[model samples]
Target: MMPNTTTLLISAGLLLARPISTLAQTTDPNVDNADTPFIQNIRPDRPGQTVTTNMLHPGQVQLETGILRFDPTDASWGTRRTLSSALLRVGFFNHIELRASQGYLHPLPGTSVFNEANPTVGPAGFTPLTVGAKFLASTNQDARSQVVLLTEMTLRTGDASFLNKAYEPAIRLLVSQQLGARYGLEANVGFRQRGFQAADTKLGQYLGTLALNGPLGGNFGFFTEAYTTWQRSTRFLPGLTSGLYWRPLPGLRLDVTAGQQFGNLGTGFTLGGGLSVRLPK
Candidate 1:
């Protein structure tokens, strides 16, 4: 029997590395501090459209839950509310993790042009379940840079009122860079299929986001972001968002966020709050 390359690499890593805690450490400036306790330093992906590149260590699990509300300046769009938005993450390897997300979309009231545009919406329904995996593509300790690749699929497993019969796929490239010792920068680029009805033509849009985060003294931190999306046939949609997060515990984070969309047809704003917790392995 011959030893494989993977086996050799694993053996080399085991031999070169010193024994350390099973919990993972994070590069996030807000969560990584001397005063912070050691509870698998949690890096949450919530309160914003931009997802972080931090990966949980093997055997770790994290849960993020939140609620969001959106109100468009135009009445025809009606109001949108997400009663429950949740994401579950489980680390299976040093550089790989599994993720799943679900949310409930409350129906829009009254007759509106929005109903015609989205025939599958306007009733209380479960959002399509999204399952994905994130892989740490590369990292540089000296440069303080990290790159992550995320691939996901929105399965046709929700209520028909939502997007229950569509197979939508998405991929994102996430990048993080540490700025000095107190701030970090994150950027994401991706594309995904978007449409409500399964039978309707779905259009894919390219999205990009840039965010900056830093500590606000003590257990508090702040983040601000700008994001935009574009389709070949449609105009670009741009938005800005900012949020504050409180980490009372090393394994928990609470955040409140607000953002507004800029569009010629109509403008909308969103407000949301969420909490993230890293559980015991």
Candidate 2:
């Protein structure tokens, strides 16, 4: 005997209702109030907002020194080099900051051919100086989100005998979001225009970065970041960085980072550290 279609439909309906009945039993009444300010305050929609304002005050000064190495895999095309550098940065106001850096770049002797038919090999050295600024467009207090607009210009002001003097102007937009009381995420996207003799021949570069930071223990915090740059060459250079920051006082901090570079023009690892001091209003 064939089963009745009406009876079969009723049986299927009961089977679907069982899951709904179980869900209703497991649901908590407190879950409905989960959107309270107490919860939202701890997990702000933006980073650098929940933290006390004194953490990043105006009239701050920071200093950093480190070593960077660039090793080209194709020795015939480029060279391996190291740079020792120092950076000094100052915050004039809540919205503006200035930075200056200088470094000695030493290139290891390598084989290269200006003309593929003729091979040339030599050692080279140069000093590079770079100055830049970062501007904050929207502060953490803003209703929308934390947004920063940054513009920087790096110029090689030292002797150009070994390296061509050049200038790079870059603009970036940065935004951050707070995940929890101690965790935050940030991202930046930028475009750089190169200036100098070969500037006309090469296209500007595009840069993108993402980072995460959070308090670790007592007064220390951890940070990690990944960045990539796209230039005229089809190949892209990428870098990864990990760092820790220590805050001894309300407006002072020390940070150290280590990372490696990867791609056609970048090779090897880098270690760096910096100190920042912020003044009260």
Candidate 3:
């Protein structure tokens, strides 16, 4: 049997060689600080569009639950509210982990475009379930810089009007770099397979995001980000997001996030809050 090179890199970072006594004896008292307690070297995705290259250690588990609201100035559907969305991640190996996410989505009481005329349709709307595998491709010895890849599949098991009944798959690349004592940069590029209903066309889009994060004295952290979606035939849909993370406990992180879209048509804004809870590794 052969060990995976990427896996080796991740282990080297998480399970560093520094002895406990040595780290404790260092002159810099905040050498071990991180943006969030749930993650080792970076903040989670709750409050920003940026995805971290860091992953949970083996036997570690985390749950991210949040509420999100989107108000589209021109959307015929009115407003959309996600009462709750949950992402569960469990580390199965040194550099490999699995994630499952599905958030509940529904329109404000009177603002639904879904057709209730068809009794066969079970529910009004819900986000499709998605599952993915995250693998660490590379990481520095100190865990200050890292690269990771994620492959995901979204099942078309939601309401008929809301889902295209297509098994959409996606791949994302995440990179992280530490610029200074308090600044960290993250970049992401991704591709997804998408198909629509009624429309005879199949579609695909490229997703990209860049973000910067830093600590804000006290148990808090801040981040700003820009992200976009584009295809060859369509104009880019861009958005800017910013948020803050607070660690009230050793294993829990809380966050609030907001984003505004910049496009000629159907522009909108979003606001949300979430919490991450990490279990013993």
Candidate 4:
């Protein structure tokens, strides 16, 4: 006599339900706790580590190099030039950093003749050097907010006979906040002094910039910024700048930027690229 199909089906169903019965038996609080990791170790909202430096720790360093080009709208009034620079930054304390940059300037041929030159008929050759410091004033971990202050001075290092031999200084304030898990916003305001001949000496220029950063994918991110500058002279020329940044490694960064002069005093286009490498903490 062959076995009944109904009986065989019932036996198979019971076999299939054995795992469910086992799971039900293992659902006791004591057994579950014994098998699972501790709540503290598995907490989902635990805060992450912060990036910091200590006196005992080796100071962090960063090196950057870039090339910049200035294109004048009226070639007769202003000249075209290329500048190359290397910047070095070192952390002195957790909240402070020092930066130094030195560069060479090369004026393009036929771009130096000033249309309205009297005694100074053409553009001058000059090497530029700058030194600066940044200080972190405040930071909040819960809010993901920070404030920083920066100041710098730039000096001309070329022949005084050929270039404007003076120093320019600037100060800036920066505020940054994390907008979301992978997005950040930054705002900056600054003042810059231009140094030149007695007739061309100008007061400080006011500047502002807004920046945004977001993650593009795993370990990849994107950044963009827009900036505006206002000169206080009677000429009334404002400038606008925009740029993008890319990071391909933990301590490496690349930036590309373009800017144009606005208003009457001077009009020009600027193109530049920068690379930075950060040292291990």
Candidate numbers sorted by lDDT from highest down: 1, 3, 2, 4
TM-score of each: 0.75, 0.62, 0.76, 0.63
Error of 4 at 79 (Å): 5.1
| Deviation from native of the Cα of residue 275 in model 3, angstroms | 0.7
Clashing pairs in 4: none
Off by over 4 Å in 2: 1-57, 69-81, 106-126, 139-144, 196-202, 273-281
Worst 10 residues of 1 by lDDT: 31-40
Worst 10 residues of 2 by lDDT: 44-53
> Best candidate, lDDT-wise?
1
- Runs in model 1 deviating more than 4 A are 1-40, 72-77, 108-121, 139-143, 194-202, 265-267
Worst ten-residue run, lDDT, model 4? 40-49
Error of 4 at 212 (Å): 1.7
- If both were scored by TM-score, which would come out higher, candidate 1 or candidate 4? 1
lDDT of each: 0.76, 0.58, 0.72, 0.57
The alpha-carbon root-mean-square deviation between model 3 and the true structure, to one decimal in Å, is 10.8
Clashing pairs in 2: none
How do the residues 18-112 of candidate 3 rate in per-residue lDDT, one tens digit apiece? 76557766644335544423234334656666777767778888888888787544344454545478889887876897999887766557443
Tens digits of lDDT, candidate 4, 1-281: 24698888889989979998888766633343322212101110000011111111128777777788876444532466676777777768666778787766555565553344544444445456778887777642123466778788887665343454568887888776654445666777877776644433356677777766556665445555555666655554555555565666656667677777666554467788877676762
- Tell me the TM-score of model 1: 0.75
